[model samples]
Target: MVRLADVAFAVLFVGVVVRAAVTDLLVPASTLAGIALVVAVVGFSLFDPDGGDHAASLVVHVALVGATALALVLVLTDLTLVSRAVDLALFYLVVLALVGYRRAPLSSTISLFPYLGAFAVVVGLFLLHSLDVSPGSGLAAFPVFATLLLGVCLFVVPRYVEADFLLRFVGALSAVIVLVGLPSLFVGSYSLPFFSVSPWSNATLSPWFVGELPVLRSIFPNPNTLGLLVFPAVLGGVVDLHRTYGRSGSVSLFMVVPGVFLAINAVGLYLTNSRASYLAAAVGLALYAAVVVIDRRAVPVLFAGLAVAAPLVGFGVFRGVVPIDPSNRFALWGASVEALLAGPTLLGAGVVNTSELIAPFLSEGLSGQSSHSSYLSIALRIGLVGGVAYCLLVIGPLIHGAWRFKRVDVGMFALAAGFAVHQLFEGYTLFQYGPGSILAALVVGYVIASVVPEAT
Candidate 1:
C-alpha cells in the first residue's frame, strides 16, 4: 500500500509539473488533474489509520493539510493566480510526509527552536509594518512565514528516514523539474507584465529572458514561482554529491550537474534582467564555494576561482550587460526605513494591499507593488520590530547548526551557509510559493537533523 501510495505521489508530482508546463495549453485539464491527484494523495494518507506514528511524520501531515486549506481559501476567494500557491504547499507537505513516515524518529523530535524563532521574527516584522499602515499588510506576511515553517519541517524529517530514500525522492523531483522546464526553452512565451520586454514580439517573451531559467515560469506563470523548485534541487545535488563521494567515483561529475544548473539559472536571471536574482545567485555561489573551501582545504584556489568566474562567463554568453536600475529598489529601502522610524505601533499597511500606502511616496517610475528588497518589503508590511525578529528567526538556526556541526557535519553546514547568503538578495524568507521556500525549509530540517548527534 505504501509503495502504491508512493507511485501515486510520483504521478501527482509529475501532474503538478505538467500543469505548470502547459498551463496555457491545458489549463482545465492540468488544473483538474493536478488538484485531483493531490486530493487522492491526501485522502490516502488521512484514511490510512496505520499511516506511521512519528513527530516528523505528523508535522508533514499537518503542514500538508494546512497548505491544502490555504489553497482552497485562495481559490474560493477568487485568487486565480494562487494555483501556484496550491502547488507549493502540496509539494512541501508531500516531501515532509514521505520523509517523516520513512524515518520515524528513534528519539523524540528535536527542539522546535529553529521553526519557532523564525516564526516569531516573521510575526514581529508583520506587526512593525502595521504601524502607520493598516493591519492588512500582515496578510502579505504569510509567504515568508510559510517558507520558514516548511524549511524547519524538511530539515527535521531526514533524521528518521534513510539517506538513500531522501536522495531518491529529491532526485525524482529534480528530474521532473528539468522535464517541465525544458519545454519552456523551446515552446510558448511567459511574461511578467511588470517587467516585460517592450517593443519586442510577445512571441519572444520568456522567463529565461528575465533570469528565471530552470523551472520555466514562462511555461507556467512567474519565474520566481519555478525558482521554488530549482533552488532545492541545487541543494539536493550538493547533498547527493557529498553522499556519493563518500562511497566512490569522481566527485567532479556530480559537481558539473549543479554547476550547469547554476549556469542556466544565472543566465535566466540575466535574460529576465532581474537584478535581485542575479545578485542572489552570485552571492549564493560565492558562499557555497567558500563553504566548500572551508571544508576541503585541499581544493586549489584555481578551481575556486573558476567556480566564481563561471557565472560571469555564462552571463556574457546569454545576455549582454543590461543597464542597472537601482532607483526603485533604493527608494523603497529608504522609504521603509523612514516609515519605521515614524512610530512604534504595529498595524502595517492593511493586510494584502501595501501598494495603497506606498503609492503616494513612491518615485515616478516605481510601482508600489513591492519594495524590491525583501527586507524593506517586510518592514513596510510588518514593521522594523517584525523585520528584525524575522531575520533572527531565519538565520539563528543556521548559525546554531553551523556552530554545532561545523567540525563533524560538512554538508549541512555548507547548505546553511549557501542559503544564508541566498536570502541576502532573494526574498527566500518572504515568499512561500516556490523553490526558494522549499529549499529554505529543507536546509533548516537538514541542519536540525545533522546537529542532533544521536540522529546523525
Candidate 2:
C-alpha cells in the first residue's frame, strides 16, 4: 500500500513537472505538486498501520499543518504574498518532517546539544524583543522564528525513526533531486534561458554574457534562495564521497562522483554571482578540508587542495576579480550592532519591515537595503538579545552534532559541520519565505538522530 502511494505520488509529481515545462504555470504547478504530495501523505498515513509510529517521529507535523491551514485562510482572504509563501513553506516543512518520521526510528529521537540550545536561545530572545516591537513587526518575525523553531524540531526527530530506512530515503531523495528536480529546473518556462546559448544567439550576444550558463535557480523566487537548497546537497555529496572511499576498493569510482559534483556546484555558484553564497561555499569547503585533515584522509586532502586551486584558475580565466564590496556589509553590521547596544528592551522594533528598517541608512548607490546579513536582520527586528540568542540556537545543534559525529557517526558530523559553515554567509534559513531554513532544520535533525543512541 505504501509502495502504491509512492507510485501515485511519483506519477503526479511527473505530471506537474511536465506541465511546468510546457507552460507559464510553474508556480501554480509547484503549488499543485505540493498539494498532491500532502494528499498522498494523508492517504498513505490513513491506510498504513505503521503511519502512527511514523507520525510520532515528527512532532512538528502538527504545527506545520496548523500553520499551513492558517496561511490558507489568510490567502483565501487575500493575505500578502509574503504571508502566503511563509505558510506554504511551513506546509512543505511539515510534509518533509512526516516523510522523515515515516522513515526513521523512534529510539533515535532525542534532542542533540547545539540545536536544542540554539532553539531555546532564539525563542527567549524573540520573546524579549517582541515586548518592544509593534504588533505587526512581531507578527512578521513570527514566520522566521517559527521556521527556525520547527527546523530544530525536525532535525532531532529523525533519531526516533529507523536508521536504515532513514538513510535509504535520503539516498533515494538525493537521486530524485539530481535526476528529476535538477533537470526540471533547466527545461520549460521554469527553464533558465540564460544557461542555453544557442549558436545564433551566442554569435549576436556580447562576450560578457556569452559563456555564462544559467545556474539552477529552481522554483525559488531568486538565485540566492536556490543556492541555499543546492549548497547542502553539494556538501552531502562530499560527505558521501568521504564515506565511500573509506570502505576500501572501488576507490576510483568513489573519488570520481564526488569530484564531479563538487566541480558542478562550484561552477553553479560562480554563475549565480551571489557573493554571500560564494563566501558560504568557500567556507564550507574549507571546513570539509579541515575535517579531512583531522581524519588524515589522503584522498580528501588531495580533493581539498584541488578545490582550493580551482578558484585561482577561475580568477586567472576570468581576469580582474570582482572588487571586494565590504562597505555596505560593514555599514549594516555597524548599525545592527549599534541598535543592539543602545538598549536591553525586548520586543524589538516590532517585526520591522526589512526595507523600512534600513532605508534611512542606505547609501543612494546601494541597489537594495534590508540587512543582507541574516544575523543583522534578525537582530534589528528582534533586538540584540534576540539576535544573539538566535545565533546561539543555530550554532548549538551543529556543535553537538559535530561532537557526536566525532564519537559515533562521521557522515552526519560532516553534514552538520558543512551546514554550520554554509549559514555564516547566506541568509536563506533565516528568511521567512523558502525551503532554505526548513531544509537546514531537517538536515540537522537527521544528523542528531543518526548519531545519538536510541533512548531507553
Candidate 3:
C-alpha cells in the first residue's frame, strides 16, 4: 500500500507538471487540479492505514500540509508573493518526506555536512539580501533553492529510491518529452515559459526550426531549455549502450533498446540545433569514459560524430542562425562581470540586483535573466565568499567522492560534467526556477547520490 501510494503520488506530480506546462503554453487552466492532487498526496502520506508506520511523522506532516493549504488559498486569492511562499511550503514537505524516509538515520548524513554547510552560508547571504534589499523579491532565491532540492535528493536518494525506480522515472520522462514535443514541432507552437518568440499566440519560438530544421521544444519554452531537460536521459542512454556490448561481439536486448532510445533522443536534440547542448553532451561522455567502463569501440565513433557536429554547430552560430548574436554574448558577459566588480566584494550584490546593474548596458530594458553563466550569475548576485561556497555546494561532493566513480557512478559523473560544462555558457541546470530546471535538480541529486556512496 505504501508503494502504491507513493507511485500514485509521483504519477500525479508528473501529470500536474505536464498539465501545468500545457496550460502555460496554450490555454490557461485554473490549476486547481494540481492543488487537489497535492492535497490528496498529503492525506495519503499521513493517514493511510496500510502505509508504513511512521509514528513520529504526524506533527511534521500536519505542519507542512497546513502550510501548503494556506499557500493554495493565497495562490487563488492572487497574492503577489504567495507563489514563492507556496514553493517554500512545497520545499518543506519534500525535506520532511526525505528525512522521514524510514530507518535512514541521521548518521547517514554525516558525510553531507560540509557540503550542506557551505551551501547554507550561500543561502544565508541570499536570505539576508532578500530581506535587506528586495524583501518582496521572494522568487529571487531560486538558484539556491534549486541547489537545496538537489542536495536533499543527493543525500537521501540511495536510502530511498532504488535502481528500478530511477530507470523507470528517467525513461518515462524522456519518452513523454520526446513524443509530445516531436509533434508540436511540425504542427504548431505554443506559449513559452518566459515569453513568446512568435507574434502569434500559438506559433513556434524565435528562430524556430522549419522543414529540415526541427527547432523543437517539446514542453519547454524554447529549444535551449528543451535540450537541457533531455540531457541526462541522453547520458543514461549512452551508458546503457556501452553496458550492452560484449568482448565476443555479442548482441543483447540491452544494447539494442538503449541504442534506439539514444538515437531518438539525439534526433530530438539535433533538431533543436543548440550548440551549447551539443558541447554539453560531449563533455559528459568524455568524463564518463574517463571514470567508468570505456567501450573501446564507441569512443572513436563518438568522437568522429562530435567532430562533424561541432563544426556545423559553430558555423550555424557564426552565420546568425540564432536570434541572439554571438558578439552580444561577450557584451552581456562583460556587463555582468563589471557589475560584480562594482558590487559588494565580500557579501556580494543583492539577488536580482545584477539585472538592474546590467540593464543600462542592454536595450528594451532587459532585467533579471541569468548572466548566461551560473558562475558569473552567482558572483554577480552574492560576494566572492558566497560564490566559492555555491561552487563547493554543487561540485564539492563529487570531488570528495571522486574515488567512488565506478560502474553506474560513471553516469552520474557524466551528467554532472555535462551540467558543469553547460553552465560555463548556459546556466539553466545550475540557475533557474522554470519547468526546465525542475527535473534537472532531481537529476543532480540522483547523480550525486550514485557517486557519493561507496557501493550505492
Candidate 4:
C-alpha cells in the first residue's frame, strides 16, 4: 500500500531528473548511474521502518544502501548537475518524510537544540550582515547550505531504513572499492572510461606523491579523501565479521568474505598513506574495541585519553616524531583564525569570505588555502558559537547512543566517532556534500536516529 506521498515524491523526482537531463544532454554515463542511484535511495525512503524485516523491505534496504554507496562514489567526479540533483532530492525527501510522523517527546525534541540552534545562527548571520558574504561566492554558499540540509536529511531518512543494513552494505562496497583500486599500485593508475577520471581520461601517474611514492587516490579526488571513504568499510566489515563469528562459532562464507574485504580495506588505507585516515582508523577501531572488549564504560575513558593525548601528539608533530610535515597547515589555520577575529562579530566570516581572506596567507605561488581542519573551517565560516553547535550535533548523540551499545549502534557510533576525529585533520566533513561528507552524514545520522525514539 503506497501512500499519497509516494506518488508525490515520484512525480517530483522524475520532473527534476528530466529537467536536469535536458539541461545537460552530454552528461557522462557515471552521472546517469548516480542519478539512478539517488532515485532508488530516495524512492525507497517512503517505506516504513517497521517493514524493514519483510522480504520486500529487505530488497529495498539493499537497494537504498547500494544506490547511496554508488551515488556517493560518483559524487567525487566532476558532474555538477548530478551533485545538485542529489542535494535537492535529499533535502526534499527529508522535508517530506517528516509529514505524518509522530513527534518525539519534548526531551527528545530538545536534544535537537544543537542542530537547530546552529542552523538558525548561521542563517541569521547570513541574513544580517553579521558575517560578510563575498561576491561570486554562490558556488561555495550553495553547496555548503545544501550539505547542511542533506546532513539533516540523512538523520530523517534513517527513521525509515535499517542502520544495520547500511553497515553491511558499506562493508561490502568498501571491499569492492578496495579490490577494484588495488591494482593501481602495480599498474600506476586505474580508471575506466565511464569513470571520467577528472583532468585527464586515461590512467596516469598521479602528480601528487606521498614521500616519493605516487599516492593512490583511485576514483577519488585525493588520497586523503580515498582513505576517508574507505575507513568506514573497515568498521562495517568488522561488524559483519563479528556477527558471523558470534553466530556460527566457526569460519563461514560470510566471515571469510568480509574478512577478505576487511584486509582489502586495510591495504587500501595503507596505499593512500594518509596519516589522518590512519589515525581515524586507529581511533575508530579502538573505540569499537573499548565497547566490545572492555565495556561501554570504557568509551568515555578512551575519549578522555584521546583528549589528553591530543596536545602531546601536537608536540610530536612539531618535533617531527609524528612523521607529518605541517605542510603549511599551521599557517593556514592561523590566518583563518586571525581573519575570523577581525570580523565585526563573532558570527565569523561566511564561507567564501573565509576562503578568500585566507588566500593571501598561502606561500608565494601557492593557492587554494582551505582550512585543512573541518573544525577550523566551521569556526571561520560561522564563528565559535556555530562551531560549538556543530560539535554538539556530531558528538552529543554519540554520547547518548553509547549507553545502548547494541550492535548497529556500536558500529555506527564507532564509524561516526572516527569520522569526527578525521575532521580534526581533514576539511571535508560538514560543509561539503561530496563523498566523504555524504558518508559521514549517513553514518552519523543513523547513529543519532538509532538512539532517538521513533513515532508509531
Give lDDT per model, in order. 0.46, 0.47, 0.54, 0.58
Segments of candidate 2 deviating more than 4 angstroms? 1-149, 160-221, 252-263, 296-323, 340-345, 408-415, 431-433, 450-452
Roughly what TM-score does model 4 have, to 2 decimal places?
0.71
When 1 and 2 are scored with TM-score, the better candidate is 2
Judging by TM-score against the true structure, name the best candidate.
4
Better of 3 and 4 by lDDT: 4
Query: What lDDT is obtained when candidate 1 is compared to the true structure?
Result: 0.46
Model 1: runs farther than 4 Å from truth?
A: 1-111, 120-218, 249-275, 291-327, 342-350, 407-409, 427-431, 453-456
* Residue-pair clash count for candidate 2: 35
- Tens-digit lDDT string for candidate 1 (14-115): 554544544424433324334433443453344332235544555555565565545434423445443534533444344334333323244533444444
Residues forming the 10-long window of minimal summed lDDT in candidate 3:
195-204
C-alpha lDDT of residue 59 in model 3: 52
lDDT of 4 by residue, 112-219 (tens): 455545544543443333223442244424443344334434544455445555566566665665666656655555457534222222223443453334556665
Which portions of model 4 show Cα errors greater than 4 Å?
1-101, 107-109, 119-149, 189-191, 196-213, 319-323, 353-355, 362-367, 402-408
- Tens-digit per-residue lDDT, 229-276, candidate 3: 566667767666665563325777646656666777877766666667
lDDT of 3 at 85: 51
Ranking by lDDT: 4, 3, 2, 1
Error of 2 at 438 (Å): 2.7
Model 2, 41-91: lDDT tens per residue?
Answer: 444443433334545533345555555455434433446556545544544
Candidate 4: residue 333 Cα off by (Å): 1.7
Per-residue error for 193 in candidate 2, Å, reads 13
Query: How big is the RMSD of model 2?
Result: 9.1
